[model samples]
Target: MKQNRNFIVGITAILIIMMLASGCVNKPSEQTEPTQITVSAASTLTESFEEIVEQFKIENPEIDVQLNLASSGALRMQIEAGAPIDVFASASQQHMNLLDEKEMIVKDSRTDFAQNSMVLIVPITSELEITSVDSLLNDSVKRFVISDPEISPAGTYSKQSLVESGLWNELEGKAVLAETVKQVLVYVERGEVDAGFVFMTDAKIAKKDTIKIISTIPTSTDISYPITVLESSEHKKESQMFVDFVTGQKGRSILESHGFTA
Candidate 1:
């Protein structure tokens, strides 16, 4: 009888141990840490790139994308200074070319993913009779704003358009230089400046009731946006994947929806 009791107790202990072992084996795995990739992109791409990152995360839940948005020239300088950037997307080919010349970009990684146009914008409530780029020369116009050509692609394009129109010298003295495109938009939106030159995409994102597009400037150079994975990237494969995603159909669709020419 004692033997039977002992056997039964032994069986119960074995069952409990097996149950504990099974629980441990069936426990959910520790959540995986997502691999992070830093992407330094032009400020003009803020909205579109944000959407693309969201969509990319749905498919690549294991990868984390961090965006560093700034003027393309400024971003390029950052990369040149070795800012741990995995990818770079420039609003103009000029900045990308600078990196390429320095061999900072990965071989064959540079791709033109989008295009944009420069536009003059003004506050909707403005009394100015400006309707075209030529109208900016009117005596009623006191001050105009543009991104600083030295550090902003939009500014460079704006200046290029003015120069092409034979108005750079005439308008240069009247121009209020902004550090970034968004600042140019702000100056226009607040009626702080008579008019401001910014990317069409930036204008589209502004409050319609506060700002109005005056005219599309004719640029001398193509306003193409190029993206590339940096040669200094530790996450080259992942960065390339991001570049592919931006240049792919899905990325193009998102960019187009945000008023960028894809």
Candidate 2:
């Protein structure tokens, strides 16, 4: 009986040890779950931002970063409509201002993070001798692709450039507006349109052999990228960290590599 009791006790102890080992393996070393943040960034930052996010993830495995890329105006409206986003990175200060005016963002967290200039692009295969925005109005040019001014900051800037340069009224009929700058690039790359206006960064990616950079809009009409944390964010701390990361060395390098002025 004594021997049996000892064997039973040993078995029980072994089972208990195994259970503890399993618990240790299955349980998280930390008591709390890592924080996660959702970021709504401008479509212009897609490639560069993805690269930066990947680097950030390696360093901050504890924090999860969710990203949504779209037109700044659309993203702003989404936040206003109560989208569960933690951070907002806009292509223009105007959109960010609208969010600030409506109290949708944490005002103190807003900052201008990067800069970009507009460029006139044409398909590489096009024999059209287009050198500037003025050439876009030529009779032979059937269509001029640009982002939608109402939704896309690049479009708005491009329109503003045209209007400021006295081209909007003359070429109004020729204008082909796209929902996003990337879409405009697509139209130009596929030779769907004769020409288009996009950020220098986007032109760098979607337009290499398929498209050619004709000219850059004046620096006076440059757009500044602004970022802010949303007031409704449940992960404000992590969100701010993401914002900081984007504005910091890692983000700046990525932006620069993609042809953005940081």
Candidate 3:
């Protein structure tokens, strides 16, 4: 009976040890879940960031990235409203300045990553000889589309370019405002508008043979891009890493591939 008891106790202890080992192996841990960072970027960054995120994941297996694409102005409003955004990328200094002034972005974290030129695009089928900005004033040109200046940097830049060129007042009446630059591209690509203004990067990704670039609009201010970590971010380390990745050589190569100047 003593020998049997010893064997039974031995087996019990072995089983208990195995169970503990299994628990340790299969137990969930904080490290099991990848860290997630949310990036609120301008609509023009859609393709480039999407590509960068894919490569970013390969290099950063421990981190997951989420993208929120929209006008810089609209994104700033979301951050102002306490949205859990980890990073902010704007197409203009105006929006970033607003957030920086309000103490909403990380100090000294703002970095200019890319520059873009505004281009005028039209449906591929339209044979209109649009050689200049002044051509839009032709009576035959019925309507043009631009983003809402109140919310989109593209729209603001478009308006600025037109105003500086002495055309905003003449074009405003015929202008159909879009909610985003992508929307403006869509409208022109689908022939819903006579002409549309979008970043040169946008024109590169348009539906094949759907749109044609007319001219690059001249703005009084250089169209610069800036990115920064938001003050409300819970993942400051990850956000800073992302900003570094985007401004680094790898990121510049990707941006350049999308027609943006580094």
Candidate number of the best TM-score: 3
Give the runs in model 3 whose Cα sits over 4 Å from its true position.
3-31
Give one digit per residue, the lDDT tens place, for model 2 in 162-225.
Answer: 8888888999999988899999999999999999999998888884589999998874555898
- How well does each candidate superpose onto the true structure, as a TM-score? 0.89, 0.88, 0.91
What would the per-residue lDDT of candidate 1 be over residues 153-250, giving only the tens digit for each residue? 99998898888778999989899999999999998989898999999999999976989888888877789999999999999889999999999999
Q: RMSDs, each prediction? A: 3.3, 3.7, 2.9
How badly does each model clash, as a count of residue pairs? 0, 0, 0
TM-score for predicted model 2 compared with the true structure? 0.88
Q: What is the Cα-based lDDT of residue 122 in candidate 2?
A: 91
Q: Which ten residues in a row are the worst by lDDT in model 3?
A: 23-32
lDDT of 1 at 252: 96
lDDT of 2 at 192: 90
By TM-score, the candidates rank as 3, 1, 2
Error of 3 at 107 (Å): 1.7
lDDT, candidate 3, 201-220, per-residue tens: 89999999899999989888
**Candidates 2 and 3, the one with greater TM-score:** 3
Q: Which 10 successive residues of model 1 have the least lDDT summed?
A: 20-29
Sum up the clashes in candidate 1: 0
